[model samples]
Target: DTTVKQNPRYKLARVGKPVNLICSQTMNHDTMYWYQKKPNQAPKLLLFYYDKILNREADTFEKFQSSRPNNSFCSLYIGSAGLEYSAMYLCASSRDGPETLYFGSGTRLTVL
Candidate 1:
């Protein structure tokens, strides 16, 4: 099926430290999205990489940073970790269009 991949399924970071997450898709999908998921709330769309261009949701535009070095790789970078940063980070890739996304098991960031 889909080849989207995320690393370090579980991560623990200290307050004020930097956290970086990596994602790669062997499919070389046209768009890749990052989302933040908390317990009961809906998964929040954070940002996405469309080919080489990056688009972030306006409300979450400043909360996170991301980069796509090449078509197959994307990285999610958080400058300073906080308790509020603790959440499940989802990575997904879609081809043809953004309507259909194939997701990888999320990376859980726990700030302490």
Candidate 2:
């Protein structure tokens, strides 16, 4: 099976509560990624892990945070969900820097 799994295909949250999204990959890929994509916009890379190392995009460095509690699972945490945060959160896996990413259908977040 392809690696990567996410829960609650869709979610709705109030404007200020903390939001937690989950993802898992069974292939044991050393790398895992989390991206936020909005309608008609590019999938913005939020953060990724190479082994136990976490790397956040410079532009989004402060906007998002993530943790890989173990090799097979990872999470994207938004301390405070905002209206702007309403979008599709995608989880992907890649074996290395330049390769096709296997993605989940995504969890669409609606912040009201």
Per TM-score, the best of the predicted structures is: 1
Model 1 weakest lDDT span, ten residues long: 95-104
TM-score of each: 0.95, 0.94
lDDT tens readout by residue for model 2, 17-112: 999999998987889999999999999999999999999999888878899999888899989888999999999988876778899879999999
**In candidate 2, which residue pairs clash?**
none
RMSD, one per candidate, in order: 1.2, 1.2
TM-score of 2: 0.94
TM-score, structure 1 vs. true: 0.95
Cα error, residue 108 of model 1, in Å, equals 0.6
